[model samples]
Target chain A: MSAPLLSVKDLRVVFSVGGTLSRLRGHVTAIEGVAGVSFDIAKGETFALVGESGSGKTTLARTLNGLQKVASGSIHFDGKDATSMGRAEMKELRRRAPMMFQDPVGSLSPRLDVRALLAEPFRIHGMSDRDLDAEVRRLLTLVGLPVDFASRYPHQLSGGQARRVGVARAVALDPQLIIADEPTAGLDVSVQGEVLNLLNDLRDRLGLSMLIITHNLHVVRQIADRTAVMYLGRFVEMGETEAIFRSPAHPYTAALLSANPEPDPDRVHDRIKLPPEVPSVMARPSGCEFHTRCPFAQDLCRRNAPPLRVNGGHQLTCHFPMNTPAQAGLEQAQ
Target chain B: MSSIRGSRGAEMTMTTDQNTPAPALDIDALSVSFATDGGTLHALKDVSFSVPKGRITGIVGESGCGKSTLINAILGLLADNGEVTGGAIRLGESADITKLTPRQMRDLRGLQISTVFQDPMGALNPVLSVGKQMRDIQYRSNLSKREKDARSVEMLRQVRIPDPEKRLTQYPHEFSGGMKQRVAIAMALMMRPQLLIADEPTTALDATLEVATIELLKELQQEIGCAVLFISHHLGVIAELCDDMIVMYAGEVVEQGSVRQIFRNPSHPYTRALLDCDPARLHERVKHLPTIPGTLPDLRNRPKGCVFQARCALAKPECGQPVTSVEVTPGHIARCIRTNEVTA
Candidate 1:
């Protein structure tokens, strides 16, 4: 794949908890036992990150965008180490690799007009050409927004319009990589599809490599070229889209797939039901992070953490992979 | 279990029966309008559908689609400023919901109908214990305090809450988001009302927890004989839970049909657009989601035509006439001009 557009290796993040409480003086180490996580995204391949909240999906996404300082990791963009970039280099990278947030309005400056908002990214990147107005007009039209909307303020735009402005700003610097975090959250169903389709079209036509962090499996199944399933800060499964969906390699991935809404109504004959909630992030399980609520957990499975291994052209860190019904302790999962 | 598809109406209560005498809840020409600060907002227009005796009827729609209003209208508790301007919801021939007086509607609620609100914390009282909140609904019944407590505990356990005794003693603030939702469902089911209205029950929850909650609801509905009006923005959950379905858009019933008919052969343009955007279909290159691509028209000054016409893809000039729902199938109906044109 000639040096993939983006590559992340051995990423780790931790936060000290209970430090404020003088009596309970200790560190609640988060994201431990997650070692040497590595993945490569092809130039135009859209990679999706799916996991329960607190699975460090957001942690990994933030690390890539340089929003959250890395504890220990190396993020390489276009064969250059993003983690080691200087201030000027980082600023350049920031413009060329802008990020989109979940809440469209939350990320936008409420006071700024749509035209000014789209222009802000260009100005930040020091693109002060006389023809910038024409460029902004092209971007607005590209995102299916009317030109008359440019003078209107952010508050004047609808949720979808705000989202279009956000997209325009992200692509303003002509970034090769776009990292979107739950981009369609809280949008009306009608608007949600439009945004998803736009992202898909952008990836294929613009050749933009995107890292999508979301809990919606349907989103993952739709736009992703490759899928990586995270659990408790570590990726439990990673593989091609078709393979991952056809035969999930990790128990966590299987549970997640089973929980997702399948188009076929009769598909819900047999599948494991999710537990009521996820465990606290501070104190993760001793072994096999997903073993806590796993239907087939045993003493051997709980005693030791499974090594992240590759099988059938995929990376998985589960003792029990979602192979066949009988293999994953499901006579019917077949 | 697949046999239930054939005996759906009889084996389970809510699945519509070809021979059954009465639908669990029959709503006819129901319209809800609000006299808001903006103006008189036409929220729901000419909505009609029936829930089978013991199955789930998912009323799926986006925000401001009058989904909540329809639920409230059925519960006989339309908001202070809102009124059912037209139509009637009948629980057999005896109850005429549109004509019911406040006292009669009050009597009808909790016994004939119950509701589970989306915000567990907001819906629940902070000062009240879980047991007290549950018993409040069942208190008027002949059941004693101990009986109510036992039933409450059983209901909690049925919803898969661990250690019901400890949970009942704790207040709403003490419970987690998923647990609070469970307690709320437990309280609503405690009444054993003939009909249950769940308004966006899992929108505030994580996608995983939301799935488990839907399963619990399906299980509870099966065990109890009440029909469920499961309202949510999630088309996936609606497909999983509903036997018959109502697809609402901008305060109007855009499409109403069986789950199979709606999924495999959606008639209305809005309904077709919704299913097309579904994440399940996202695997391929979707050039355009073909969304009903405009915010719902301001309800106050709603144009005197089809509300979805502003955003609809197959709309014609004549669609400007007042939209009327007609029989699209033996049991399916839709209120759109291009119902036949939408190949979805």
Candidate 2:
């Protein structure tokens, strides 16, 4: 395969809690939001990150976009060293890879009309010398919105319309990569289908690589080529979307898949109900982070951290990985 | 007016079965309108459904589909601008909720019908401890403070909260999101009301926590034997947790039937489209998903005949005239003129 469009290696992000007073009193503590996670997105491919809130999926996405400070590890985009980029290089990177936030209406400036919002991206990157009006029309047409909608403000547009405007803005600079966080949230089922179709169409048309961060498994299955399951700032499982859904190797991944309620009354809902409490990042669990919630957890899981085991394209971190008898037998023999 | 009365009288006679008890809540041809600047916006137009005794009935609809309005009308908490323009909401034996006095409605609220809202934090008081709030809700009872505390502890235990005795003294902030929702459910059921209305109670929770909450709710509802009016936009949750389901569109109940019947075979164009729109139901990866083309009609100037005519693919010229609901099967109805074609 050709070189990946974007590559992240052992990336980590740490946040320090308490104010300066606490620091002076030697009471400061650090929490690893994204703890040494790595992944790669090929050109025109979509990669998804799925987890509950505070699992550092958003933090990892932000770190990739250079919005959050990376505590360690390296990042490479299009064969360029993103971690060591200077101000000019970083600004160029931002233009080449724009972000789409979660809240559709909240992300866009309420005061700006659709035309102004779409044109703001070009102006920010100092490309205002072009025909801004024609550019705005082109964006509106690209996202399948009417040209008349360009005059409407953020509040005037519906949720799905506002999301279209957001998409138009994200692709305004013709970025090689787009980072979308919960792209289909807060939308009705039909409207969600519209947005997903638009995104899929744009990816194919523009040859864009997308890093989608969402907890919606249906969205992941629909658009993503690869998926990673995050738990307590680490990837418990990563594989092809089809393989992950068909036979999840990690217990956490299985639990998450089974938890999704299917819109079918006949199907037996054999759900693995995890405990409600999510451990705080500040107070990390002793060994396997998911041991407390894993239904198949044993004494070995609590005392020793499992190493990442790779089988073909699939990789998982668990002592007794499901659906692979060879690995389970090897662990048992040990 | 006489025609409206005639239909309501017919419905009453049909539901008056001596063998079976009256439904916990029966809404007959209910209509609600809010006075806005443009005009009187009919939020609910001749809506009718019944929450059967000790059965779970789920209402599924998108925003602006009158789910919230229906809940408010049932609880007598509609805004000042809102009014029940037509029909009656009968609770139990003899109370027509539209005619109830404010004091009587207040008396009926927590004692006969209880509510569990979407946001647990908002439903619960931040200043008071869980135990204090639970005890305070029982002010209408003659039980002593000690008895109330004991009942609160038992309710918490029933909801599977660990260490119910000590957890009761903690503030709302101390509990996790799922735990807070569990506490909210406990408080809503503490009065042992005949009816429990859960408005997207598990929507704010994670997928794992959501399943857990649904199971807990199912267990508790069976134990308490209370009629449940579960309102949510999520088709999956409605299918998983409800015995019967109502599909609302443009402030009208477009379809309703048993959960099995509706899921197995949806008759209405809108209901079929909605069920098809669910990504989970699609087994194969497709380039584009099926979508309803047009937006909802304006409530103030509602379209002439069918509310979903503009967006429906199967709509015809005959749909321009007023369309009566068709009974697809026993207790299964669809408000669409082409139900025969769709079902066939």
Candidate 3:
């Protein structure tokens, strides 16, 4: 529909996992941050990147805005190839797709007030003479903050308030795609709702495409139209949010959903107790990266990595996919 | 389990009824204050609740709601400027925790009451191996060095730490966040404390790890027969693991009841709002979540009447008067003047 806002093909990112000394000695180990990932964000749709820590969600997010160098892949933004884009084209790509961080306090300058913070984005884009002060107040108002907040410094605001300011700054330039990484984390339940709703409202009002990277499934259920579950730098499951939650195609997705403690006490969950914590990225398992932790891992799963297979609207990489009556019961139980 | 429970409360084994056991911890009109540079800040005021023997009692509140302060006060680990102005913390029949000397409190800490903090990395020493840290906690006991090492391994096994022997030798940095938390839990339970206070223990964990950790905590508590005081802001976690729940706001108890009672029929406006605010509660995705309208009142300002009145949508003129808890059900209580009007 009207060309996807952003498209990626075999996106792979790597990092040297040691200090300068090791790099000089030519013995530095290479760690895959985002390994052979591919996805598309349709225009005006909210896409979610769901994963636990070290799942490459943040790495992929950084690559979207050209902040992280791509080891190999194509990032086509607004029908433009970002990977091969020249200096001017890359600048335009960044101007159209901004990134929002999880920690508002760390992202924001302590000395700057809300007005300056919001106006900085405009100034960076060379829109210095566009009544920047008035625009700052409008951004603050758009995110449901008091107009008077423009006068207050970041430190003076509460955690929720500061995060709202972060959202305001991200949307200051009216970017088509906003990459919000763990936006509602560390906020109170009510404040989380407030922030989520604010993002939803901004999307609807501005017709903005959102790429939210978060571990919180509840947020994905609420705001995201499509979801991609990442594990050890690769997508394990990707599909519509409703389909993924209703009947997860992959074992990791099933385990993750079942593990989410629903607020309802009466709704009994069939918790799939994962054997051990997610394996460190330094020593990612052979074959399927998630085979070590997958409950349905078999000899085939351990020997050869499953290709990303698409069925109906869902796409997953799993050898022994859980699509039987037993799997349906897990979904129904929730 | 029965043997430990019986031995701990031999003299005070009086049960309220055949169904209910004596509370492991009872607080009566407890008040705690911090001497700030500006003024004396009342962190907790007239707060009263009980952790029934062998049950999980959750203290649910947002930041600055005095949940951490209450836990610190109970553990005798409050900040230097903080003081318990008035109240009685009766642990057992004759043990008044508030009156205990510093040395007595230190002796009672790991032996009687232990705590699991929020950040596992901060709670553990990064330099020392897990075995060394765990064994250090058991050193004061009469057990020999060999016995202490065995006990550390056993506790690690109980928490389901994979390859317990190998894990014990690894430093904190080597363990994943979830594994570190498990080790922290194992260390907290190494002494077999009668009361375990966990302050947002799973807040830093992933959702999957968090559920597993909570399940482990529940299983261990049942096996050890210790009263647990779980402090958290996540309603989902509290709803799942807690037997009884306490809702606090701005240093005051706004609601207290059984988990079923609270979830099924929250009588307080604040609790109802909190539940409504949950993304899980919304069957269909909506544009804006129903917010509580305003932030919690500043601790320094200290609202005169109901602490939640400032942000509460159901606040009435009568809320300006002093508010005390009124029973909404058999054991459920809500500290709102208009408790009868509010519905879950």
Angstrom error of the Cα, residue B151, model 1: value is: 4.6
The best candidate by DockQ is 3
Write model 1 residue lDDT over A111-187, tens digit each, in one string. 88888888888777777764778978988988889988889997877788889888888877778999899888778
Q: Per-residue lDDT for B1-344 in model 3, tens only?
A: 11111111223232335555447888767899999988899999888777778889998888788988898888888999999998778785546688888998999898888999999999999889888998899868888878888888899999988778888789999988998999999998888888999999998998889998999999999999999999998889998999888888888888887888889998989988888888876656666777778777778678888888888788888888877667676567788878888963
* Top candidate (TM-score): 2
The Cα error of candidate 3 at residue A109, in Å, is: 2.1
What are the lDDT figures for the candidates, one per model?
0.77, 0.88, 0.85
Which portions of model 1 show Cα errors greater than 4 Å?
A: A20-36, A78-90, A122-136, A153-155, A266-268, A311-313, A324-334, B1-24, B35-39, B75-83, B89-112, B119-151, B169-176, B204-208, B281-324, B336-344
* lDDT of candidate 3 at residue B34, scale 0 to 100: 94
Poorest 10 consecutive residues by lDDT, candidate 3 chain B: B1-10
lDDT of 2 by residue, B152-210 (tens): 99999999999999997999999888889999999999988899999999877878888
lDDT of 2 by residue, A52-142 (tens): 8789999998888788999999999999988888888998998888899999999999999998999999998999999999999999999
- lDDT of candidate model 1 versus the reference: 0.77
Interface C-alpha root-mean-square deviation, candidates in order: 3.1, 4.3, 1.6
Looking at model 2, give its docking quality level: medium
Clashing residue pairs in candidate 1 are A222-B282, A222-B283, A325-A330, B13-B53, B13-B54, B14-B52, B14-B53, B14-B54, B14-B55
Over all chains combined, what TM-score does candidate 2 have? 0.94
TM-score of model 3 (first chain only):
0.95
